[model samples]
Target: CLGKEVGADIPFCVYQKVARVRGIGDIVEPFKLKVGYDVLLIKPKQGVDTKIAFEILDLDKCPHPDINQVKKALINNEPLKDILGNSLLYSAEKLVPEILDIIKECKERGYEDVVMTGSGSTVFVLLEKGQDCRDLIKFMEGKYPFVYRTSILIK
Candidate 1:
């Protein structure tokens, strides 16, 4: 959903609850602290450029640390601005609102923890317990078109 329009696909590793191993429809084992759901492992495409996965994102076109923009830029698949001279971002304050809005929306939707990953344009939320991330993806299928290439994010 989130990557459908962007061409990026969100490959998740789902684990169905072990307790409900005998059910046709999905069921929740609230008492189980670590209930497993169906699992789906998604690996990114190969040959992709180095991303902010575990690297620094130099986007302010300078030197500093605006982790948010770095994350956003990565999500947008924008080139990482090398921090050669100085300055981390050109106008981070101006762009922060957009990131905040994304985070806010996730919260409104009931995500317990939403964080901007590395110095990339991607914003992720680790939910406590509620709706499927797929539903959220379906909801955000349009807003970001550049994220589709994420399949190759760490390639």
Candidate 2:
């Protein structure tokens, strides 16, 4: 069970909802953050080992955004770019080359706020309301075998 052993963000991934997961992945506080967006999830051919990725991360160099500020951003419907500006995705990039490539491609395709999700080989791009994400999805599908157009499961 690497849930609590590996990292605190594991359980939050399982729920796929708005939450403030605390206490080393044991405590989950679900909250409502009224926001609307679509996500294009891209999983590249290469696999990234979480253990090795963790080994390479300099914990001191990661950006730790305040939970309250995140909540405020979500509730207030801040631009996706603004909300993800302080994400730790930058630190995790070097360990996952495939994910980084996808991020770069997404940016080139005019997508904003492309981020690697939770020790990932999978990266997601946020599409604001009314944006035509079909072209992005199609492009990713053509490039990668596993691409999903999904939404945040806010409950």
Candidate 3:
């Protein structure tokens, strides 16, 4: 794993719900999710720089979701409605306005668990378990530069 090669103590290299002690290279632990969610990731031509994203972030206005609540929701397979959100979404959306349009499009299509992953332009729509996203992927591929169908890594 890159974390191990870099001398960071961590259990996994890549996965969701990963908690780092002091961010990135710090002590990291990957939390296992009970239910795997089929997801459609759509990214526009524009990309947001991670550093610039964080630099413009306003913690005062951005959401501060409870990490513990998010972890519990994932582990217990609970509905993610008010509990899951990204702190960097505000800054990312500011950098790339396409992010908002993508999210709105997803919600308009009846997908509720839409969120901007990490720092940028790529937005993901979490589908119900075992739900097929081929139609969504096909629709998104026509609009966005990059559209992919993937799932959460649940162990």
lDDT of 2 by residue, 1-155 (tens): 46656667777676777887776676877778676767788998866676777777676877766667767777777765645643445545666567778888999988877877766778888776557888888888888989988776657
What's the distance in Å from true for residue 13, model 3? 3.5
Tens-digit lDDT string for candidate 1 (1-155)? 33334422221212321221112223322123222122111111221122322234445344454545544444444433331111212232133335445555656876534544323234555332333566556555545432221121121
Highest-scoring model, TM-score: 3
Candidate 2 has its poorest 10 consecutive residues by lDDT at: 82-91
Error of 1 at 65 (Å): 14
Compute the lDDT of residue 58 as modeled in candidate 2.
Answer: 73
**TM-score, one value per model:** 0.33, 0.78, 0.82
- Poorest 10 consecutive residues of model 3 by lDDT? 7-16
Compared with the true structure, what per-residue lDDT tens digits does model 3 show for residues 4-114?
576443433444453433355455666667667788889999999888998999999988988788778867888876777888989988889999999888877778788
Q: Which pairs, if any, clash in model 2? A: none
**In candidate 1, which residue ranges exceed 4 Å CA deviation?**
1-93, 128-131, 146-155
- Give the top-scoring candidate (lDDT): 3
Off by over 4 Å in 2: 1-10, 13-16, 65-67, 85-92
Measured by TM-score, how close is model 2 to the native structure? Answer: 0.78
TM-score of candidate 1 to 2 decimals = 0.33
Error of 3 at 72 (Å): 0.4
